[model samples]
Target: LSAGFDVADRCHLAPVGAAFLATTSSGVAAFDRNPGSSDATIVTSSMLPAYRGILLPLVYGPGTRSQRSATPPRLTHGPNETFIKAAGARSLAVLLDVLTRAGHVV
Candidate 1:
């Protein structure tokens, strides 16, 4: 927990009401059917708002995922950071598929 966030801590914000799919800890999510948020899947603090999801495929591809060749490069984690996860080609492909199906017509 290098970020010092408790595992059980919830975000101070909630997902947008009409966000058919919201990026979440486990991946994009669909909230519960009922409105009370009782069985809803919530997003983590790192999630961008659903309104920004149209930017996902453009942002998640290739070097951007790990910032491997970032300009003025920086490591996302500290020396003690245990997890180093990123969306590789296949994962990006899957996300692209999801975005395509989301139908953001220009």
Candidate 2:
């Protein structure tokens, strides 16, 4: 169950095995299927030349079930223009990379 950050946030009803590609203030995040714990893990920011982004593992907790009804703070509100632009650029770069790998000229 892959989706954008917004869609992923609303996916509180998603199955336990589902994973999502979510964007964060610093970089990108992915839902991790850690059955033993509910806490999400944050991997150190990668300094590798091929990839340079924070790896945040978003895990579903008891609160996730009620997220649909709760008024969660949105990341799209005021004063997030810079982060939005950076996230967009990173998304585009990933898309282009995937396309290029598939033999499509970009």
Candidate 3:
């Protein structure tokens, strides 16, 4: 993430994007705040689809603090990026999904 993506400034992120990230990060942090809690107790279906199902195995929740996986999806702007030409809401939605997976706790 860029330095501008820092939640404090509200710089690079769209409003919804920032909110989603902030919320997700808080959830992760909450999990970290309590380590002895069983993983199953914290891994809830409310997680985004990217964080759900068998692939959930790929992520190891922090015991006492909120932490995200190493490689959450990213939304990049490039000539080949299809969503670039789409409507603003569409692109924003895609970007929000990426940020959500990245564990932004809005």
RMSD of each: 12.5, 16.1, 17.9
TM-score leaderboard ranking = 2, 1, 3
Candidate 3 lDDT tens digits, 36-91: 43344345434665543322111222211222322442233323223323344543
1 against 3, candidate with superior lDDT: 3
* C-alpha TM-score for every candidate: 0.25, 0.28, 0.20
lDDT of 2: 0.34
Q: After superposition, how far is residue 36 of candidate 1 from its true place, in Å?
A: 23
What overall lDDT goes with each candidate model? 0.33, 0.34, 0.36
Model 3 CA RMSD to the hidden true structure, in angstroms: 17.9
Runs of candidate 3 exceeding 4 Å displacement? 1-86
Among these predictions, the greatest lDDT belongs to 3
